[model samples]
Target: MMYQEYVDAITPDQEAGLKRTNGRMLANTILQNPDCFSTSDRASAQTILDSINSGVQQDAVDQLHDDIEECVEDATDEYSWSNC
Candidate 1:
């Protein structure tokens, strides 16, 4: 089956799991639903999911770092320090 078919076949439970895991559940779903996904498809999905998850994590960390820096800068600045 194509990737879109596999995606469309995902059950409500799997959808919830995907939301909870930030899509990390995709690899596990591919493994569990072997009837829907071929071995090569599973491998490709896992690789893609890993790359996406890694990028998401890095983006989150970058945002947190930026927020922290902004907060610190605000706290140190004489005009904004009081509000911070």
Candidate 2:
């Protein structure tokens, strides 16, 4: 089975699983079928996996920034009490 064929064969459930793992599952899948995937195919998969990891990392960083901003705003509001 070619790499593209493997990708095309993924079911909706498998796709959801892939998304949930940030594409990490693809490494196992490719490893299990080493005889089927060529060097270029493996390289392509690695590229895709790297891209997924990069996106996930960016999302985490963005969320952290948003959380910190919210915390700072709350702290500022608390300290700005007119009674003080």
Local distance difference test scores for all models: 0.69, 0.70
**Per-structure clash totals for the candidates:** 0, 0
| Number of the predicted model whose lDDT against the real structure is largest | 2
At residue 47, give the lDDT of candidate 1: 85
Tell me the TM-score of each prediction against the true structure.
Answer: 0.53, 0.65
Model 2 CA lDDT for position 84: 78
lDDT of 1 by residue, 17-65 (tens): 3543544455666766889878897887688677767777887899999
Candidate 1 worst ten-residue window by lDDT = 15-24
**Total colliding residue pairs, candidate 1:** 0
lDDT string for model 2 (5-70, tens) is 555665676654456363556655675677877888678778767877788788899999999999
lDDT, model 1:
0.69
